[model samples]
Target: MTRSVETTSSEDSELSLPAPKERRRLREAAELTHDEIAAAVGVTAATVRSWESGRTAPRGRKRELYTQFLARLAARRQDGGPAGPPGEAKTARAAEEPAADPPVPDPPTGDTPTPDPPASDRPTPDTPASDRPTPDTPASDAPSPDARTEPEQLPAEPPARVPVPGPAEAFDALYALAARDLARQAYLLTGRGALALEAVEKAFVQAWDRWPEVATDPDPVGWVRAIAYEYALSPWHRFRRAHRQLDKPPAEPADRILLDALLALAPANRRTVLLYDGVGLDLPDTAAETEATTPTAGHRLVHAHADLADRIPELADVPLEKQSALLRDLFTALRPAVDLEPRPAAVVRGGGERRTRLWTRATLSLTAMIAVSTSYTLMTAPTHYEPPPAPGESVSGVPPLAGPQQLTERGKQLHDKLRADPEAGPARIAPRIE
Candidate 1:
């Protein structure tokens, strides 16, 4: 197919790259951000970082694109443009340095020292009469300023003044580097693209809240990655309405199979495989990150490999390490470019601060309520028990029915007779009772 040929051509056209260090140096020299490079190359910023770290290299379309970008970056330096990225003041300062008078070179020497010419041969208008050397002066004496013949000394390179990014800038830079990769990794763990991005953003938000601690951590990227992974793989996410549905699988059959195999894994085995393979972590590190003992981590990895082999027959033939690379490839196919954009660093940080404040307020209110209730109870509660109230005696003689008293049988009869006598009612009044 045309696609196969294109991929082959791209892979075959790998550029003769410099040392991995050179790649990083070039980018830094240009003051380019990792996100910019990653975006242009159709890969995640983490992938770009790994490339510069020499832990991994791009292949296929990625290789061709990355090579082209690096080449351009190098060319930009060669073109005599500003050493820093365009529009930086560093270029202007660098320009001014070359214009400054270069350091004067020492006079050339030979076995027979060349004689200094008399003051008549070279006009020493600026030289003082006493300082000017005559023909009688020995060559060993300090040469007059005009007699200094060495080529103009090149300007000393200004101490490489690298601008240190501020805390907010540093956090944003880290976010730019790790956010995309974390999002992709999260997508690999959870089938939903939206949830994956959400998890990544949430991880950054948490990191921002604890910026001091996170920034000081030895492996800030790994710290963020671990948090993202935890959020993505959390069982509680399954309970969320939004995450209940799975995202569509990658359109390519190969990528879809890889994803399906990964999803079939139990979360532990899945996480172990991902950390060990997908992220290119060593065995010990994978175990430590997963919070498992080495032996347990190894077993999980074995099981994961077996499951993947069974589900993806082709992988059975590949070596364990290469399988990890293939796993990484699946992340890029999970979503398109538009969906991959994570929330901005500023927005994420602000949200985190707000969330922390809300929790703090809620906690203080709850504590206040508990304290008030305790004080009120202490004040109102009796110090000792009082004597009990007496029990009521049983009542006898009262009618069971509760209502106005019933008329006697005689009175009822007389009432009935009066009713029968009609107009005689007045005479038949109850006065008889009196």
Candidate 2:
């Protein structure tokens, strides 16, 4: 079926998949190159080529835009709206060529162990102890009658008890719920199914590391939403690298239009509006979700409104004339973008075993190499081989020659010194002076 939403201004063609001829005509009418359209939708030029070739139809936002782009073209044509210059389209297309990939850092070297910084540099202060250690127990007043050597006993106090929710239970509940909500909001704002899922997953991983604090918060969902929004806008998310090849934009005109509109948005504005209006979060809550102040969030929402009014004029009037329609159009347009289907949770049942197997293999390989090299060296060397000495030099299992005599000499000297002193070692006892 034709995935694009129907509009009054233009007739939509059949939607089994956009025909190559229909897509080309739409592209020509919109004055967009395949690359330009692809860049707009954040896909690869190859993908765009595929769409035009009738090999595939753009899914998600690209699918949603099929009707919207044509309608916009029809509207512009009717109104004689000045088409943006040809050079602008050409320049944008040129900019879409894949750039050089960033250099990946090498994995950590085994030679260098990560050193722990000194305790003094640690964030929290250490609790200092009192001058004297507390005694375990005072001397007992009386001994037991059962035996003369019976030891004195001290009374025992009951163990102290604390009451609070279990940390892991609370943490799990907050993370699971907040993560799901954040993913939904991301899909709504970006309108890209994969992007929304990624944003949610990224936010949850980050939250996992700080669950202790986040779980205790009054609004964990808000916190997760904010994190997801930030992640959605990150440079990494902006450019998706699948396999070794760059993204190819969808070829269909509708897909091109939708992609272009989404790309036009500044990340912050898109995130703010989605988190606030789309997810029904208040301004303060939106700010919390986006990690911004209320004023900043308010400004983003305003800019988002302006951006919407400037681009996509069809949806604009509804929002302007009927506040409800504006909200409805936004939700409708964005719903496909952010829609996340039920997914199986990631399972790592045998991860430990796999890791252990890998380590074992690596160790065996390394050991084999070392043994081979050592054996080669020993075999090739000159033939006069001396076995290592036994632990002790003396026969009959007696210690080495320097052991017993030295201890006996030390003991004799100590005894002679003690006997030579009048008070054993000149005691420091108080004297009766009188």
Candidate 3:
């Protein structure tokens, strides 16, 4: 069962191979079929599989040969050769070459590298081979090149490969930071928690859909905020069932009053005030966001402040220019009556995609239907034209088509005379002699 090859030394008696899993991977990568490996290793295909699977290992001469074969495989792989055994010709040629008189021993693979000796002990152009300092010689006995390491002291660049955020990651970061706050603001506008959350989610969906524009925008958050505010303030929402009824008021009397005041304002005025006072935007910004002129935005803001101040005495004391601080503080103090949780980024992105798909399908279907209808009308229409009838004309003496009149007595008697004698009728009518 154990046969040792003549050339197999005690050191080569044992073999070291990769782990079972790694062996399988390497074997597959080498394009070595089970049969090819089995033939090369002088074993059956099943035996090769067993070896690779860690079910068994070769012993004696077989183990030695297997180790050599693995070394050849790795060497061949490193050399980038075609999938085949590493050539023995090179190994044999190396073995046949002459050896130097003083053989330098190969370094141990696991040992730490020895430090370089001083420059003086190192072999220079004039130094003899025997006189040159070896690793065993002390560094103090040699010399140092402190100059070489001094250049490393200057400041180096910041670490490279910083892993910049991708588009999706950046989008998610923006959403995570802004979604909750945006929803709260939306709730302030709509006075409905669910609608507020829906508005923010839909806004994010659109933002993701147009991410190229949104990402490149100088103020992505503001872009998203505008969309959310527009959706929350949309008049069409009033027709929906969810928005038809008033949402429950907040617990705090002050917040409830403020929310009521806000909701009562026309959408334009409310948005302008929210942007200017609550969101801390300037008049020009508020005007831009609300799609109104600066004067109009200011007008709305002054009126809104007046209205709110009328309802809330605290705001009434604050002047228009100073109202922003008070209003922003009041809005911040207002707690949402309900939990307004915005959807995940994934959900918003996927919903946007789905909505786009449905709209695209509808548009295509409509186009197809129109094309078919036009085609059908063209195919089935009458091609030939019948001549139109000539218009009627009025004659000079033609009487109107009235029913026949009753016969007179003279005509009746003549008719009786003709019936009595046919010849007398013609002779009386024809001659009429005196």
Q: Pick the candidate with the highest TM-score.
A: 1
lDDT of each model, Cα atoms only?
0.75, 0.57, 0.74
> Model 1 compared with the native: what TM-score?
0.56
List TM-score per model, in order: 0.56, 0.37, 0.51
1-434 in candidate 3: lDDT tens per residue?
A: 21112322332343265566756655654656788776676655776787787855554334556677776666655565434343222332243467776664564344767666567545788878778767699766654444444465667878778788887898899999899989998988888888889999988988988999999886788899999998988889989997888788878777777888888888888888777766656565567778889789879988888888888766776566456656766776787778888878877877888999999999999999999999999999989997999999878987778897878999899879878885764465676557
> Could you tell me how far off, in angstroms, the CA of residue 386 lies in candidate 3 after the best superposition?
5.0
Q: Which regions of candidate 2 are displaced past 4 Å?
A: 1-180, 189-192, 237-240, 243-260, 291-293, 319-325, 332-339, 342-434
Question: Which of 1 and 3 is ahead in TM-score?
Answer: 1
Q: What is the lDDT of residue 57 in candidate 1?
A: 66
Among all candidates shown, the one with the greatest lDDT: 1
Candidate 1 per-residue lDDT over residues 1-434, each given as its tens digit: 00111223322354366668988887787667798787687656777888899876665445667778888777767766557544452331253365668796676666767676565766568878888667688866956656675677798987988998878999999999989878777877877889989989888988888889998886798899989998888899778898898887766666677788889999999898877666756565677899999799989989998899898766676677556555444444344322667988988988888999999999999999999999999999999999999899989998687786788999899879867886575665556653
lDDT of 2: 0.57
User: What's the residue-level lDDT of 409 in candidate 2?
Assistant: 81
Q: Rank the candidates by TM-score, best first.
A: 1, 3, 2
Q: Write the per-residue lDDT of candidate 2 for residues 22-113, one digit (tens) a residue.
A: 66655765567777776565545666776777754544344556545555545554454444444333232333466797685554465977
